[model samples]
Target: MKLIGVLLFSACVVIATAVQQKDSELTAYKESFSPLNYLNRYKDAAAVRQYMGLVETGKMLSRDDIFSLFNPCHRQQMIALFETLYGATDFDTFFKTAVWARDRTNPRQFLYAFSVAILHREDCRGIKLPPQYEITPHVFLTTDVVRRAYQAKMTRTPTVIPMKFTGSVNNPEQRVAYFGEDIGLNSHHAHWHMDFPFWWKQDYGAVKDRKGELFFYMHHQAVARFDAERLSNDLPVVQPLEWDSPIVEGFAPGASYENGQEFPMRPDNMQFADLPFLTVQDMKLYEGRIRDAVSSGFVRTADGRLVSLNSTYGINCLGEVVESSTHSVNPVYYGQLHNDGHVLLSKVTDPKQRYGVPPGVMEHFETATRDPAFFRLHKHVDNLFKLHKDLLPPYDLSELEFPGVRVEAVKVLGTCKASTPNQLITYFDESHIDLGNAVDTSTYKEMVDIKAVVSRLNHEPFKYVITVNSKRSANAIVRIYLGPKYNWFGQKVSLDVSRWGFIELDRFPVKHTVITRNSDQSTVTIPEPKSYPEMMSEVQRAMRGEVEFTYDSHYRHCGLPHRLLLPKGKPEGMDFKLYVVITDFDKDVVSSDVTVDELNHISSLGYCGVLDGKIPDGRPMGFPFDRRIPNEEQFFTPNMKVLDLVIKNVRQKPME
Candidate 1:
């Protein structure tokens, strides 16, 4: 009898193992990497062309003929495969150029520029590279080569800039200059959640500089007081609507309108006005719920038009009160940018002060470099907006808040070193793009050219300078620079220069001049900058709610889904309080997407007999029919009252 029992148990174990393996396919997909597989799959010439979004042109080329677009980590991973199947190119010139630009903050432009440089084979020695000089794609001889080159260009250190080499450093041919402008319109979707601590990963040639995701860990722990809460995957999480042990609180005046007697605004006005109290309350709850969802892992799409979500992503206001909107919250980034590469802004305010001049609002305040990235994943919201642009009502985004608006911005870069005060370029002109202007205008949603206020190189804030005149900026005041010239870790430097008329300066590029432009177009005017506010005077620790102000509408888009943080100058050991708030917009807007079927998924086979996780019960939103087996109570933190409430009010589960 004992032998038969043992045999039966062994049989059950094998069956359980097979079932578990099949269910664990997702992790396997992430690890599915192979050189042989790549070569074998691309052996067919037509297939290679298809992979690159190109048609077959009957070309014969070795696997090396193709280019790659991976990073150092990936390169290291596929070392054997790369060496065995690919030919090499001298990437020294490319590497030097990449670091130079990445040291700044125009990484996007750098990536764009790198693409142009290689395709045209241009000499990368001089500045003033014009936008017109063109090149030929025939140099590579086959679509596969061009496609391979493109991939290789992205992944390799010495990326191929947009310009082609014409045998001279003075002039280069522009190859595939529009490549960046032509790719997926939904690319913005991926920006919010691409992973974290990008300092080591950036390449390509750019003019501006940017900080990475790593800052939050040290910075928050220092400035924002809190117990160690491991980010849901070491990635920047989104901000929840209602404050609950938050790191920052966002506050701002809701949108003001020019009187709703107008037509388009009227539709929304009435919809908002007629909204039932309960309906509006539910909307607010949804907004907070969405915030929880996004911060936890939900992403937005580019055209998804999660318009309300944009409220959480950035600091902007739209409503009935109207006029001079300012932000109670601020974000940390390189700076702002014009629609085109026209201009760049930098940080200037003191760490304690609030950012955003009146009439503007706080937009997004988190990095997407995490396991579940909001930057990259959030594009679904935008994409949805784009796909159904017609069905949605039109609204003017023309005068909406721009991107890269820092609370205490100061320009510490340019030919004009520390000769001026820490000058912060505040106003914006417009945002332009390859498609046309920043706004669509077809609907009220017009995309404007909001430049990175404090970025210059590809993507960084390596060094900043302050100059006086818009042109021939030869002076500066304070000089500030991040990153270590000697080693890894953050550094801060303070300098003085009363005569330069500037506020601060960042480290880097002792050459090159800083030029300013005044729409006034009269003689260049002097800058009279405002001082950082008092509320930001001695920030120690504030709840996330205390720090930021938010506004929302019927659209689920308005919830606070971006993590908010205080731009602490010395985040090494500061402690600040944070708050999260939940409010109902006037109306409840139903999601255009299909209704979500409350899914109750389970993992693991019967090997362990029973499994882990909260076995929900009672069913309020229709779920958890008291199906407890084992390992239940692990999902919610004991500190979370909402889960406790849900378990008590919604489910029949007893409060722990």
Candidate 2:
């Protein structure tokens, strides 16, 4: 008996020790390894110095340059592989937490940029890294190095802008990014970080078989390769990533700023369908691996009649953290508005541009940055379709306000097919994309079937309080329409409660509760017209009155004066009409309402405007100052204090 007892005690002790060891390893893995670390090694001391010297010479990273890093395969898919692995497991706080935090961080979040700079410069044809640059290829994709980058980005003080960094550290770029501790999430005093895009961009490397490189495709060769063997052996796997858990100081759940951008529901900017790893198979390569990643959950068919018992990546509406209210997936907002080409610019190359324009606000033009965070969020968004269909039961499409808004698959925005209004990419799939293309919304007449999204739906309409506010009062007969487009003269917007009553409803009873018809309230009566224009004028007065408040209130003005502008130099001027289809990624089309008259009357404002003057021809003018013949003896840069004096006195006050 005593011997048996000793054996039992020994077994228990051994088990406990093993558990402790495993826990420690997991903890260390989460805390130490960060994408920032990977960047420094790729950058190294010498590479950083050279990059900075170039920057001082007015050289900046171009969109093509950063995108080039993802070519070939190995470099592009490295981080992508890790993100997949992070999602494979069930309730792994370390992985999910990191993904959510870093993805929202700005694209150029310095620490995140370190990795981008490394991968971007790796295959540069323009300039070769100096011979003295002593970076080993190992630096390109080392988990350990990534850990170091995170530490640096977190601990640095006094802020880490590149110019200042160049003067202090040998690798100013890396140092500034790695030691960007001062960069907080937002100004909320929240203890979080701010950076997301580049971290998402590192998911894949370029595909090639160079002497010093691996020639593997990301979805299949790299990720699915390990994934397949692990499933066969019945064991867990570890994945490499760019970074994790990027506590963005400003991004917290329920933040008044966070509107429709909830986690896991919609992909970033991707309203239709979460674009998965478009395999080469669709284009003639192998990409099904993405569809067959992990068999963790289940899904139902598109028609909602069939259900697959086993789908990969289980469903969790809420994350592991008890406080979080969701864990579906988010859509990717890839800087391009496929909803009909009206993006901030031709190529929203700036990573900063990915974020929402603060709903009713506008940010600086220079503030625009490409948001890679949207891509990461989109991965999860795609998963939501599967999870909702298979594991978690989603509401009926008919009951959804925008009924099946996400079911449609449109052209995944890749190439800029529109050189002019007439020239647009009509169709995009694996084989033929980037061609001048076009599409009609549907077989139906109205555009309602195109990309419209509502919150919920019900079989019958319900009571709703209608509030109409307009800036102009002409005894307006608020003519709402049954169709999605504006009624008759584009003068009013009418929503049908009979078809979309649940949309206005805030919440319904738990479980499945049927809404009955109260006989007395059978028909909700909307009688005479109200003076909506007066109400709207109150709000507009406040906006335009305080120049600082709602300066450029055009795009949001659905009531009146929010017109689409035509591209300049078009032979037939200002005829901007967009043909929209939920499934058609190509949005440029024709419409009668967006006539030349309306186009000519569109509001004009700059992405970044100065209080001094209004934007000219769709572009914002800088603090208006005359071209200066600076005294060679004088000192200061274009944005220096001395320039302010030159502009104030030398240049007249600009007017609207």
Candidate 2, superposed: residue stretches over 4 Å from native: 1-50, 53-286, 298-388, 394-656
Residues 1-656 of candidate 1 have per-residue lDDT tens digits of 33332222222222211111222212322344432234343223332223222112322122222111122222232222222211112333232222322222122222233323322222221111111101112211122323433344334322222322111232111111111111110121121111111221222122111111111111211111111111101212233222122223111111221111100100000111111112323433433433342343332322332333232112111100011111101111101111000000001111112442211111111111111112111222222222222222222222121122111222332122322222211111121111111111233232222211110001111122223222222211111211111101222212111111110111111222232322121111111111111112212112222432211111111111111111211112222111110111111112222111211111110000001112111111100111111232342121111100000001111112
Q: Which 10-residue window of candidate 2 scores lowest in summed lDDT?
A: 641-650
Residue 120 alpha-carbon offset, candidate 1, angstroms:
9.1
Can you write out model 2's per-residue Cα lDDT over 405-510, one digit (the tens) per residue?
A: 2212111111232222122111101111110001111232221211111111011111212222222221111111111122223233222211110001011111
TM-score of 2: 0.19
Q: How far does residue 382 in candidate 1 sit from its true spot (Å)?
A: 26
lDDT of each: 0.19, 0.20
Candidate 2 achieves a global lDDT of: 0.20
Among all candidates shown, the one with the greatest lDDT: 2
